[model samples]
Target: MCQDVIFHEIYSAGLLGEISLGLKRDTVEGLLGEPQDISVSSTPYILNYGSLQLSFSSNDPHATLQSIHLYFDEIVEFPHGLQLEGWLPNKSVSAEEFLIHAEHFNVVLEEDEQHTFKNPQIGFKSKADVIVVFTIEEESVKLYSIHLGKRPR
Candidate 1:
């Protein structure tokens, strides 16, 4: 299948994950297995990745990814296509930077106690449904998380 490029920012500043945008549909499929689903409008196409939703404009390049929203995961934006080629000392800029570039709306990062990058037991009903439970060591910020239902509601 053919698709506009998509990106995701599910990792923290210190973690490792590659979520690029404006990727060719086949390229994205190659990187992310395949979109959980797909939708289309007159001038835009949507591809649903694991927890990432991408929107592309027909006015943009063939693989021009417009934006990405990782709904529940803390990080949910991307850097402009130019900055990556510079010396940023980052895997893909910082979470703070991605937010500004994404023009984030009324989203909030709960607490280190609310989300984690390690062994997070996430489940899905479709692709958007997520249940996250995490904890932070009061002084150190060591994080732990489990599936929402593994314990209870």
Candidate 2:
């Protein structure tokens, strides 16, 4: 579990702004207006209505948001192709659904592009995969990302 979590209104809208900065929910609302949907779990509650999916942690501060900040998984290259192991979307949306919602997406080509994952983890991959990155646009926000390719095997 995350040790320190803070909630501010602006952090939500300001995530991509500074990346070096933090966001607050109120400021997000002020900029983006309102959330389209909200998903809550044991620890994090995600606010999704626009291009941004903001997740708020419900933990204490000695470990603020940065304390447990998760580093993005790197793309690893296999012998014949590249592998995609971990990628997070901030929601439970399926790869297919996500593909449809993406304004633009691209794949990182591999040699054979025929590598098979032994198992496809719920949100992460058990094996490597084709890299994908998508950009989605919303009223006051846009999601810029690098993602894993999820085309049919």
Give the per-residue lDDT digits (tens) of candidate 2, residues 83-128.
Answer: 1123334333334554443322222123222332323221222123
Candidate 2 lands at a TM-score of 0.30
Q: At residue 27, what lDDT does model 2 achieve?
A: 46
Leading candidate by TM-score:
1
In order, the Cα lDDT scores of the candidates are 0.36, 0.31
lDDT of 2: 0.31
Candidate 1, 1-153: lDDT as tens digits: 321112122221211144444455554445556566777563567666544566665533355555544443343333222122211112233334433432342223332423444443212111112222332323222112211111123
**What does the lDDT come to for candidate 1?**
0.36
